[model samples]
Target: MVSLAAALASLAVGKASAEDWAGADAETGQIADIAGLVRLAARFPDSGSVALRLLNAQLAAGEMTAALQKIVVLYSRGYRLSAASEERLLDMADADQAAWLGSLFGRERQSIEASTVFATIPANALLVESLAQDPQSGALYATSVVSHDLFVSVGGGEWRALGLRDAAALTGIVRDPRNGMIWVSSGDPGLGSEPLPGFRGLIGYNPAKGAIVRRIAAPEGSNPSDLAIAPDGTLYVSDGLAGVIYRAAPGAESLEVAVPVGTFRSPQGLAVVRGGKRLYVCDYRYGLAWVDVPSGKVNRLSGPGLQYLDGIDGLWLHGDALIAVQNGNRPMRIVRLVLSSDGKSIESARVLEQANPAWTEPLGGTLVGDQLLYIGNGQWNRFGEGGAPDPDNPPGPTQIRALPLGK
Candidate 1:
């Protein structure tokens, strides 16, 4: 909120141009005085863009309180918020119910050309006699960052439940190759309508404790669908809802942003293409798309069998192409896509397997080691199946199943 005096002063400036807001690099060097922006907006009155810029400025400065306040102001003024913006604002407020407001409301750096390799899982957990298991024997599994003990399940059998360090939504969990510490993302575990103010990122999990004892800040509003690790240890996580990709490395303070920058929309399943720095961003509905780490641009792969590859939730680099898990109850199928050397073209894609009619659901998945794929098979109607899920807590049950990708 700006003072009457400052508001009156901005009235003199009249209008602000594109030059008014700094680039991602120099923006922090610019002042994050929300009051000043508000003043300028007061003068222009038609400064919806200015208000949004101010909001982003405040966010970069860690002034979430001011940032969110401005969102409310913008909304009351009929400022149409994008999904990404609305989600972040709601995530900051820790509002779950606010998610229903999606229709209304609602980084980067470096030049690393990415490559990808694929993995396989023939079957997700086929619920036989009411039990589930992991695909990879040594795979690490945690329900979310906000649970009991961080559970690391080895072998394709029932998992012993463990809790998380804090109450952060579990985005993507991957075993860090360097130290084997499972890196996880935690933020306002995006669950309810009213969000919790002061909510931010937190991480944990150590070798000895088998849980995250220390936490850190992660990028906001990511229900990370898939986790990818570069040979260089560059960490990548995909936000299913925001269509944004978050990059991080070991011992980094904050995460970095990637291309198509949520400016595009709806990327659920993501993976690194083998032999290159190109990351494939599979849309919630579209087929496999590639993100050039250097240019920060995205190119969608489509044609013939590649067409209508909807509800892709998981991606992996396999051999000369990429394999994806189609997320749907009826339209369920595990498909494989071959990429061209140019990286811009898709040669062919095929459905490797389909879910059994009896057990009709699948979500995100991962291929374990050399032979198996672990599918996070979800339950009917509820989240986690057969659990004492508190209304305040999510009961989204998704069991890990072992599928043979090789055979």
Candidate 2:
């Protein structure tokens, strides 16, 4: 577990953009002043990082009552305090407060038991981002961030690289259910060794031929991150750097903006729902939102039980619910958010996995039958300047976990 101060500092230097406010406040730098953090906590009430920072500030200022109030609110939202945080609160509390704190800590849920490993990738496949599985043949394909290549594993056998031509730091990949063609999102995040001069868009690969058949370029200045395919063959891609969502029609040659800029701060994951009428997008800094495909109207998903939807990286629709991989949250978790009838609000949320012993950082996944197979140990932090792997501290073998979604 990361210390409170270190977490606060990490949130302070996050990406600066209109939609990048998931953890930090509005200002670009650290919010050391109590008044600023108070406003920040109010703005993002569900953010555990902001609440912890404000609590630390209050304790440092000798405002015990305010600190206790924040703790109560956090507790109500199912946020657990770290061991160090609990000790600090206990030291400042009176007898009644101390007793309440003890009870709160006692009720903390134990870590979910580790899931079964479905497959393991060798160390060469650096920073695997997203995954796709062929429903008919059980062939698994993974996208790499550092290597800018696609890897394939057949029948749970050894992983081998399938070279992509002129690709730049592959992010998202999905199999088009209509025609069985594999689609992957390609973008230059300034991390790859070989920079492709004038290409940042989607690549359509035919797995049977082992070749890329079609290529569609995104608009200028776009870093497409995640891909979602609707039932009707329309493709949706999220641009994390430009704060836009692009859509390409069934046979269109180029991509068009579905949700324009200034809408989301940094969109990461996308899920199409309601027979392709609605699209759910996960903004890394903001929470979850759904867009009306025809009218382009966006609505923020809200409910009494939908508290920590801000930090999700990968999202998939399973029946009426949404399974999210939330690597951005503290003590990163995999959550299941049950939706309402109309898909406008989240009815309830359940933590499927948290504090797992196998996680370096869970990134993206795809639904395979009754299980969600995802990248269990995405070593994104192992990369240094210019997205190069550190020779001295090389990443270990990557594990992909199979998390069962029980009926």
- Highest TM-score: which candidate? 2
Predictions in order: lDDT: 0.49, 0.79
Error of 2 at 21 (Å): 14
Instruction: Report the C-alpha displacement of residue 300, candidate 1, in angstroms.
Output: 1.8
TM-score of each: 0.57, 0.84
**Per-residue lDDT of candidate 2, residues 189-297 (tens digit):** 7665555453589999998888999998888778888999999999999988778899999988889999877777678899998489999988777577888788888
Candidate 1's residue-wise lDDT over 314-369, tens digit each?
Answer: 67777766776665312356666666666565566665656434233555445555
